[model samples]
Target chain A: MSGEPANREPVDLAAKLASFGEHWSPRVVAGFNGHDVMVVKVQGEFVWHSHPETDDFFFVLKGRLTIRMREGDVTLLPGQLFVVPKGVEHCPVAEEETHLLLIEPAGTPNTGDPATAATKHAI
Target chain B: MSGEPANREPVDLAAKLASFGEHWSPRVVAGFNGHDVMVVKVQGEFVWHSHPETDDFFFVLKGRLTIRMREGDVTLLPGQLFVVPKGVEHCPVAEEETHLLLIEPAGTPNTGDPATAATKHAI
Candidate 1:
């Protein structure tokens, strides 16, 4: 690859989980340019917030998650994807539990707030 | 989420494989802004080419592969990532078999050649 190539072996979700044991917190899995790719295990409910200057993408690696927005709610199952626009307030919740792989800019606040506890957990 | 947020559920490789059986070809799993995130099942050998105006990224979701470059070769496994800079000629091959998740600009040529056989498979 012409871009900064990082040669790595195959990594499984079970192996990634073995590296951490926290809920609602994300851990760094890899990086590209100035961005950080994170994997998070979430259950129950998460606070509602929005990123004003950056874009965020989420892919469920395992389980299911429901994203509640100011206008409506979107439930995502395996193989499906949803997009939340910039400055759109949203809350993510899982009726049971969900595992997700998220990609975004480095230093993005977890809760989209610089002063919130979730912000402290940014991977 | 500030970016074009795509809410997607956990998509396992086996499930994705059940959707296709072709080798060296990719299918679209999701889209980001003007870009497309694709998953490809590849084995054996691939041709040499380069994208001139875009940056391409690859994450080894499964298996093993090596990128042969003019200078040297880089072997990649799962969890490892590589960025192929624009205009760099590179060839990919596998000693065994490999699956990968590739993200790049939508409508990009597969072999970086707009008129080549590989260009017909852009997902």
Candidate 2:
């Protein structure tokens, strides 16, 4: 565990997904390198913003996620991934209840705007 | 796609996992920042090595993966993850035909040693 302490205990996916119930709020489940792997249940639309310095990786675990960008929208079904590069304007919309895993730099704000209530909550 | 071109197509995970039947070899499926999101079907034992400057991340997509280190071995099951810090000698052994997703700096060899045959192939 000391060698890979971030996630030494094997986390049961279904159990972790079932542990939380909320929307747009990410719960940190593990860490890798300098990034944090988080899970969130989302529905409706998220704020339009962009990370100025790091990319955002999103993997759909359940349902679907449509990321609205300047050009078009990218819809991600379960088992799909999308990387939103830094400094790009984007918004994520979940038409139905969607389970997602997000990977990004540690301590990154949930929304680009720091004042947003959903900024950087580990749990 | 251009804004988030690395994984713009929203890759079908099942299809990708289904596409390949081999084990140990990693197929590049997408990128985040400068990192590669890869999936590999692994079974049996891997070499003992370490990346000197970058951390290596392993996520269990199916079955289980055990990373052996000096202190102890970290066992990862489905939905579990672990980050091997830079310069840590480690070996990965999968008890069964385990499917996994690896996230790390692009161009990293499958094994730490550069002379290894299984070095950096994007399938």
By TM-score, who's the top model here?
2
Q: On a 0 to 100 scale, what is the lDDT of residue A86 in model 2? A: 81
| Candidate 2 lDDT score at position A30 | 67
Q: Is the docking of candidate 2 incorrect, acceptable, medium or high quality?
A: acceptable
Task: Compute the lDDT of residue A12 as modeled in candidate 2.
Answer: 55
Could you tell me how far off, in angstroms, the CA of residue B112 lies in candidate 2 after the best superposition? 1.4
Looking at model 1, residue B78 earns an lDDT score of: 69
Tens digits of lDDT, candidate 2, B3-103:
44333567666678888788888888777768888888999999888887678878787898999987678888877777778777889999899998888
lDDT for A19 (candidate 1) = 74
lDDT of each: 0.68, 0.79
Supply DockQ values for each candidate.
0.27, 0.47
Interface Cα root-mean-square deviation for all models: 5.5, 3.9
Model 2: per-residue Cα lDDT over A1-123, one tens digit each:
223333345655567778778788888876666887888889999998888888888888889999988767899997788888887788999989999889878888878776883754554
